[model samples]
Target: MINSIKTPNRLVNEKSPYLLQHAYNPVDWWPWCEEAFAEARQENKPIFLSIGYSTCHWCHVMGRESFEDQGVAGILNRSFVSVKVDREERPDVDAVYMAICQALTGQGGWPLTLLLDTKKRPFYAATYLPKNSRYGMTGLTELLLKVSELWKTSRNRLLESGEQIVEAMREQDRTGYVQEPEKNLLYEAFSAFAHSYDSRFGGFGEAPKFPAAHNLLFLLRYAKEENPAASEMVLHTLDGMYRGGLFDHIGGGFSRYSSDEKWLVPHFEKTLYDNALLVMAYLDAYTQTKEPLYRHIVRKTLDYASRELTAPEGGFYCGQDADSDGEEGKYYLFIRQEILDILGENRGRRFCEWFGITEQGNFEGKNILNLVENANYREINPTMEHCCEKLLCYRARRTFLHKDDKCLTSWNALMITAYVKAYLILEENQYLDTAQKAERFLEEKLSRDDKLFVRWREGVSAGYGKLEDYAFVVWAELMLYQAIFDIRYLKKAVRFADTMCDRFFDDTEGGFYLYARDDERLILRPKETYDGAMPSGNSIAAYVLGKLFKITGEEKWRERSQKQLRYLAGSSGRYPAGHGFAMQAFMDALNPSQELIALSPEQEDLRKLRKLVAAKPNLTVVVKSPENGQELAELSPYTKEYPVTAGHPQFYLCSGNSCAASVDTLQALKW
Candidate 1:
């Protein structure tokens, strides 16, 4: 007799670390594949789909409690075809089911569990079920049995419900088709955020606070001479987060989010997307306020990423796990004595007192090392940088944390933009060089036949590129061109933008889909416009489209961008906090970006010109050496006829079809 049982199942060959984590589960888990669906049909069983990332703590907890239990595995194997999906790897699938889960339960998160019919329509959805019922929660076993009974007794009703849910989702997505946001939309968004701003804490809302860095960026732009409150909100939030335990005082990167409203305790997971966006936010804060602290945070966060998250091959990794030694926050937390021992008694005691580290501890009798009380690092210890080196060295000797080494295209592109921003603001060539190297890695390793791929690990790349990947890559390219005056990067941005429209744009609908039409695995393609932990792909696409139109003066790009803004404008303007990224894009459309064309051969003069233009909000400045005029003219056709005014460098401020008179000196170059 042939053996029908496989202990490791099919996930053993999967590239995703989250999927591989369950490869040895007692439950026979198949990856989200056609074979899994086929097996469900063959067995006449409901499909159990679980989606999460490698770094999710609840995902680990659920795996340990239910997936590892032989009894639960037996029940699962006998009645349901269980399939696991890494949400990070297959976000298109996750988004569709997550929308259902949120609609049914009114909230959604990781370790998402759903029961689907053989046709792959979901009838039930949930997040993080415990093994045994407690705290008024339903246990996995009871839920499994209940689902099985329902499937058996009311098969037709269950199928109908699943069909209805899918159709409802499709209908909901199709309903919003508006043209252009109202004139007062941006003002309404600012007002909504102002009303919700946590004055004492610096962020918006209550416990489980996220950074919401994009919102801060939007506020920074909104804070003009008329709206000073916008800048105050941005500054307060930046100060609060940096002073909290959410930021690693020693290692110099931010955690995923704060578990508490005060930003004292964090979830402990560190993500590339968070740090990248945070760096951009901090940079914006620095530019607006000229605050040294914001600049320091940007440097520290980027340094941490370069040291810890970056691969030897030049690509940035996905994230670091929350748990170490199978315990949450073990690697991050330090005992009072441990800190004392790490540094000598005098230095350690001083460090502890300065950082609010004590024997009582803020988190489970272990210090999280925050500056909540004494927010000023320089005031507490002028030699804080030296002190951090000691703590970082000591922490390095502890139990090693798990780092998710996969280089995601969207995330890497975001990091590249962060570095470019840092360079533009701080005038740091090293930051610019780092950005260029990462971009080269993306192009050389992640691109095949001139098309970008999404995931890359250990020199291998797989998965079709998503809208985020295309949008962010275009964004990075545009920033790179602005920083280096490279025509090649500009051309590349245009090419990718064209490709993005071809692959992800919905012809009937104005917005871009998360997945391509040809991507057959997804049950329904999702068009996400809301800015979550990261900006939505559609939001970035709209923003990038606006910028492209400004740089290339393409009316078609502007038209497409306007269409997207119009489609999303009503909802975004109504809830600006929810659609911060889209609102930023809409704002850009209303005021076409200003471009400063400086024909400067001298490096010093070019730097000065860059500094002058960088002060302006939402401006795209191009600085070109006279030697590269021919190629630059070819790339940006409008710049072709305009000759260098004198042997000395000259600057022209261009807005739409008009260009101001050329100025030989930076002082005369008026905004």
Candidate 2:
């Protein structure tokens, strides 16, 4: 049956791991193109737009449950023009539809399903419906029948709702936007978080805890600037997660999200974004406390990335599937007897005790460790080192981990920043080298025609770079510059930033648009700024501009950054908690930041620069080429006075209005 349906899809020729994933689906699905929409109109059939990415756990679930069923596929093909969209490659379409779905259903998530009129107006929307009616939600068949009935009998009703939804989105987009001034917005966000703080468990609110690593980072920034309680909220959550089953104690990375509030039991899905963001949060936590365990998490997460997710060429994969053998959590969840079988009697008992695995079990007679429950027992008998070794050995046996081998540029950029920052703080060269290798992997596979593509699976690069790709990579470039004084990198970054300004920048509006005008058409061209689960492109654009201004001594960059703040000023108060990550970018906008330009070749300057950078709280440093190093010399000119013994190190410290004295020698570099 699947073989019959594979005949008409353009996905037959595509290389994306996600596209290939649906290649065998019995539904005659069409990839997003004018062709599918044209066919829908010609056939006078409604369109079924199924938007999802390769890594979404529920996406996989819906695919297996609905898409793979021959009977459901037949229904999908006959009743509607089924169109599949990889949200990662086409986020613009995803955003518009996701917004409409949330508007119609009052909730939205992946495996997004929308039944549209032949005219391409959404009439009905739902996410993750079962093939047959089982759960409280309606069945896919009944949904198709109902929508078809409406399309034939009450077309005006569909059109009216569609028009209303779009108009509502436009009005909201225009209103509730205001400019951020200081930590008030951030403090307000923290104040909101303070209300939701789980004093016992650490993360905000109750059950289904997402790592919200960026939120925690925002908390730390808040802690540093506005309130101690804010930072405490982050650290306590980190402690809870680390101690919880949310963290795979043996494996280095985090699962998708916890099933319950305590972070003890997870949905058992490991994702690239979760791990990447968690790595960033843990690294930041280590920066604050220098606690050995947090440092261990930093290395462990990286190690996990290196071992499972890393492509042979060096870039990381998109994510790992939560389901295997048609059973969710089967690959990750373990029975008590199996643990003893692999690890033997003595080692197994200790492992079971450490992981809190018992015969009665935590989940269906299986154990998922809410690990640090018996902290006293662990502390007195075994050191953390002993526990780590045993757990690590036990975790190594899970060989069925499903890694989504599609390398994504935006996600990789985040990883690069995390790795670069970790190496900077930890003084580990391996992490730095791995960061460089990942960057090189992106260039080799994802960049062509000076335009970066989004996904790299097999050998093909798919889609033009999204705003996230440009913004995060620009941020990563600056971080790379800070870690190693690469002049070429600065030049390259300037060129990319300039390209971004030309292609995606909104000259009329202050903020950067989500995609270039040439990008695939969607209903709306929204300029996103507030951070959600992921960082917003507009916020990141503002972030880059602020950092670039400090680096190049350009006033225009500063002006642009300020304008973005103005655009995002409204509605920021309403969802300040969700906007925590972007608030860090907002903090950059308000601060008179200095780009601590280091003047030297890449080698010696890197060594000298690390000392200048290490252990400095709240200092944002940018390394510049030795040649233009003097251009910023007016900022911190004291570096030129004292010649160093080994290799010359010149530092230029420029803030908002004035330049501090530059220092060259280690002695002169004293703060």
Candidate 3:
């Protein structure tokens, strides 16, 4: 009987560590599958869906309290068809439930619990309920009983509510913003951030400081526009954050957020999405400024993901849990005694003092792995290349924390973009190779026809891919193409972009929907434009659509891109955060400013041509090799084609997409 039960709801372990975590759960949970829904219908019971990613602290808490509790298990097994879902794996399922939970609770978080009718329509949802009910809310047992009772007594009401929500979830607005965002709006947003900026702290808001990298990205662009200090403010905050506790000095990654505003304390969970986006931001900063510290963080963060979060199958994992053994931040937190023991009193004291690891400790008598406690690695600036190699090794010696190994396409795509960008900036060929390998793994492994699956843990693919999967993957493919000029990546991206335009793009409303038409239903399809901890799909779509137009020169793509940007432009003033998409979109909207520089076989010619362009401010230059480099060369009217007459040096100047006539020397193009 036990073997038979396991076979019906069994998850085929593929690559995710998170799904495997539930492989042995007694509740007879199945990954998102038709059989499970069939079972629910056959049993004539509501579906008990638990959605969470691996690194979620609340997810871990809820699992220990409820899933691990045999009493709770008994109740779940007897009344409902229980299912375990990693939100990262099956974002469609999570997205639907999250919408319901947020609408009902006014907020939503991990460890999402929901009751859906046999048709997979969610009638009720909540996040992280305690087992025994101590925090003013009802206990899990009581809530379960009440929901079950409601299902039994008022099935009609549940159907009505679920149907209405499903309809609402399908609706999308197709009208673009009335006009493009004016300069005043950008100025006003920057001014607001400055006024609210925390002088002592790195972030803009109070406690639970999210790394607001999106806002800072806007700030950097704004600063480059006119206000020099505006850019400085962003850099200053980033510097503080890098030095603060939010960055895991020893582990080579960042925590979810700083518990305090000053960036001295963190919530301690390292999310793959957060790290990936942060690395992108940091890499951008490093590219423009050549800041060593920013580059260090980027490398370290990438190293951490590659070492710890990567699956053997070449895909990236979701995250690492924030807590361990019921104590918050236990696996990561360190005592002063341990530090002293690890590196002796002198270096340990210095490390503690440098990273703010005092005798009293920063969090519950244990020091979070922050930079403040370390010796001033920045100021000292010894031969240590960001202290990542040694620290990551040392941190490994301790209890390796539990990792969430679910591979979400969106998150993997983001990481892919980061790796591609880092490869471009650092000229590290390995990063690019790794990026392509991971992309291949997703394409060959997780994709089913045109529809993409969100999470793959332990070799099992579960959950429907949402709009995020398309947006982020398109963005990643674009970067990958740019990193190596691959046509295949571009072609794949083009096909997916079309689907996004046809299916996910809101024709009546200018914004995009979070889920595809064929995906599961939730409270609302949720046209999310706000840039919260991460940039929203609507915003991402706008940016990606704009890029596709630039790459492919398709006017239809450009129009769609404009529509997406315009959609957000209407609210850009009120929601500056929404402008994350607008920022990248703005670049494409500009008059195509093109500059091409060609190099002869001579080194001096290359340097002179590079300096000529680099010396100019606000201009982006694209370089080409002399061998088979005619794509840009023949197109460039400014730069001479193949062999230079001088045979020593050559140069090209171009305007718009077209280049000026080729010049034999840099001096030929000079005034």
- What are the per-residue Cα lDDT tens digits for candidate 3 across 344-402? 77876766666667678778888765564344545535423333345556667756677
lDDT of 2 by residue, 1-671 (tens): 14563454567666666777888877898888898999988998889999987767788878888888888888777878998888877877888888889878898889999987766678678899987788587988778777778878987888898777777887876664445556677768878889999998888888878888888888886676657767778888888888887777666688878888888877777777778888888877787787777887788788888988899888988777776666666666677787678677887777778778889988876777557666743232344446556656766565565667888888998898888888888889999999999988877898775677888887777888988888878877877877775645566566678778878887766667778878875667777766767778777777787777766656677677777676655546667777766677777666444445455534655676665554543355654444655534443343344333324556666666666786764456534
Model 1 residue 336 CA deviation (Å) reads: 1.4
Q: Which ten residues in a row have the lowest lDDT in candidate 3?
A: 612-621
Q: Please name the candidate that would achieve the greatest lDDT relative to the true structure.
A: 1
Stretches of candidate 3 off by over 4 Å are: 1-16, 41-43, 164-181, 188-192, 287-289, 311-314, 369-377, 380-394, 427-430, 436-465, 484-503, 506-510, 516-527, 571-574, 587-671
Per-residue lDDT tens digits for candidate 1, residues 1-671, read 11237356678788888888888888889998898999999989999999999889999899889988899999999999999998887777888899899999999999999999999999999999999889999999999998899888989999999999999988887776676676477788888899989999899988899998988888888885237779988888898898999999889999999998889899999999999999999998888878888888998999999999999888999999999888999898988898788787998888888889999998988889888898455342556678888778978988888888889999999999999989989998889989999999999988776578888987789888889999999999998887776788998898899889988897676889888777765656778888878999988998998888777666778788878888778557547678888778877767655777777646777676567546765677766666777776655677776677446777788776678998877678666
Worst 10 residues of 1 by lDDT: 1-10
Better of 2 and 3 by lDDT: 2
For model 1, the superposed segments whose C-alpha errors exceed 4 Å read 1-7, 375-380, 623-630, 644-648
Candidate 1 TM-score, true structure as reference: 0.96
lDDT of 1: 0.85
Which residue runs does candidate 2 get wrong by more than 4 Å? 1-10, 176-180, 376-399, 595-605, 611-618, 622-652, 662-664, 667-670
TM-score of each: 0.96, 0.91, 0.83
